[model samples]
Target: MSTSSPEHAIDRMEDRLARLPLRERKKLRTRRAIQDHALRLFAAQGYDETTVEQIAAAAEISPSTFFRYFPTKEDVVITDEYDPIMAEAIREQPAELPPIDALRAMLREILPQLFETDLDALKTRLRITAEVPALRGRTFEGMRATFTVLSEAFAERTGRAPDDPDVEAFSWAVLGVLQAALYRLLDGKTTYEDLPAQIDHNLRFLAQGCPL
Candidate 1:
């Protein structure tokens, strides 16, 4: 699974989000494609060094088209599709499944897809994300968004506010585990394959609740 695959999952959701109106969906898809292209440029040349015009040219879109999708170069950095897809996944889970269990099930559906893609590109994305402060912040912000989306889904399903302490705690805990695992990977402390298991164990620890 390449890193780009999960991000591509975000692109597909952008396609679906655009569908309330046919024209709007088309716009959303184009914007997402532009963002993807821009990220590629940012990854290739340093984010600060890569100009919007360059990204637009690479994507075969107008510079104005780039501005249309992302107001600033930084905005384009914030486009991760995982939240919407994860929300959709949680929504699809059977009502009877406990919230944590539902999340675990949903992750199973999501993570395999990540690992299934071309590994090299994903590694490149990870490498870029790790090295760039702006990209790293944007990536974490995206993860925070993902956690919020999950918390909202759980709250809706379980009749609790998304911001309920437990929900917030669970959301952050999952995110924290993923961050830790990614850190391990980038730090040369663990293999990519070790991530899911490490994250799973951390989440399990959180789910079981910390003993006082």
Candidate 2:
């Protein structure tokens, strides 16, 4: 019953979007539509087999419009919008809370957004990442990009240098848990709704120093 769960974060995002100018909102919708259709097409056909023109056609946008939103086809799967949001959430967590507790809260804040996401699309994306070596490399690069933001926030809270070993270790451990949870979910070991509980249990284990 955390107050700052995914639904709450979504509510905040909705409010912010509500205040955006009409043009900006329309742009956001168009970007989303393009991404949604791109994923659908990518899932139906293999990534290498799917062309940008096909994706654009499915989304009812021209190829030029697709490029305006995403620089390349790989960018659609590589770039993640949640990284900054979660990083900011982690930074905004109460200073009085313990490190793990703060991280848990941050995860909760984002999980609701994940819940609303298209699980089929996510599974397809993960599957593609697993199957494509180039995409896999890009995915790791994308993860490193987010890790920099998260590690800095962790360092600030711990009063350590951003590159301090302790900060890096803790950040990697957290990311590892999340990655494992995601893989398990994609592998059909867990359902979409079970993600929160699985993440909660893993975080609790880490909070307890990873007991056997």
Candidate 3:
């Protein structure tokens, strides 16, 4: 797979979550709608001008319910549910598998959920994230958080500190492949159908050997 970063991976996973049962899909869609509404207002009025109450009102969600879903106004844009699921998926992977291979497998395993989400919404989210500075930072922060999760998994597998450079670098490369594909998709240069193989081929080129 093309090397990918955590943001791109999360983006992909969020895409898959769209494939859940109608109830689940509806929940996620509503969540996405709230986020879209929040972002639209934030963009139109400026971050400082926006408030959770405004977002809640715009989303047609109760203020209390908005708090139930997100911690703060800024969180509506960044704190998506898919991040934890990705980490759990990684952790659930057989420990014997190399971390990079585990990530690839995890991506495959998670594909069903990806197919559940709306591609159009994903593209919109990507576009908004690209244009917004706060969103860009939060996206990278989300990536960094995933790196932390991956580091722990790698260390657990290899008996090294999670922060060890080799562990981190290896994790980084796996994410790099996904990011490459995402950049292409976000730019209208590639379609989701073409991404997996494109990412896999690029990843094979990078892996050289060692089984991934």
Candidate 4:
């Protein structure tokens, strides 16, 4: 089983917050509160039916505060607290490892963080993103941003430019594997504990040319 225990994940979050200035930490808390309330509202009602004012009221913040944290309703579903942390973890992988190997290592390291999340909320977010057209576009945009982050990490490790064909290709493949794993996991096709192993297995197949 993955070793990313809930306590450890919470600790990581707390530690991260500890390093931030007080104002920034407050901003993060407000953002998280807004997102949590928004997802709950989206799950209870249809995403299209849930207005920003309702979400803000539920979160005990004004609509203006919601706008300050999330530029639009779609951003609530598309953006996440984990992307930057994941990118940093990817960068922390041993320099001796190949780009794909580094990504594999990073994924393994972060799997337990998944346990720290509210699974139902995640499922709701995914469902909304999958079914809503606007959310779908925003999802793609978010994925593009993630690709850029991973590509830069790969490029830095390999002493290449972010747009270098090799760097871009490798980053896409890694992100693709991650996306596939997440889709399957969120579909309830696999046990939560098996998530990391599933990703690692698929990454291995990817490394092996995805043989038949």
User: What TM-score does candidate 2 get on C-alpha atoms?
Assistant: 0.74
Clashing pairs in 1: 1-115, 1-117, 3-122, 10-81, 18-25
The candidate with the higher lDDT, 1 or 4, is 4
lDDT of 3 by residue, 1-212 (tens): 23455567567665556544667667666777788788678667866688888998998889998887676665676555465456667777888887667766776766544544434445556766666677777766667766776678777778899888999898787667667777787678887777666676666666775354
Best by TM-score: 4
Give me candidate 4's TM-score against the actual structure: 0.83
| Candidate 1 residue-wise lDDT, 74-157, digit = tens | 667655445665677778899999887887777776665656542444675677777778777777666766777878998988
Q: Provide the overall lDDT of each model, using Cα atoms, as 2-decimal numbers.
A: 0.72, 0.77, 0.69, 0.79
Tens digit of per-residue lDDT, candidate 2, span 1-212 = 23455566567766655665678667766776787888888877878999999998998888998899888898777664555556667878999988889988887866766555444556677778878888877766677867888788888888999899889988889878877887787678997778888998888898898888
User: Judged by lDDT, which candidate is best?
Assistant: 4
Model 4 CA lDDT for position 150: 85
Per-residue error (Å), model 2, residue 149? 2.1
Instruction: Candidate 3: list runs displaced more than 4 Å.
Output: 1-51, 58-75, 118-120, 209-212
In model 1, the worst 10-residue window by lDDT is 12-21
Please, what are the lDDT tens digits per residue for candidate 4 over residues 1-212?
44566777778767755666688677767777889988888888888899989999999888888898898989988877666566678777888998778878887766666556555667678788768878766766788878988888888999999999988998888778877887786577876667779899989888888899
For model 3 the local lDDT of residue 27 reads: 66
> Predictions ranked by TM-score, top down?
4, 1, 2, 3
Tell me the spans in candidate 2 whose CA falls farther than 4 Å from its real position.
Answer: 1-10, 16-34, 44-46, 56-72, 117-124, 130-138
TM-score of each: 0.75, 0.74, 0.64, 0.83
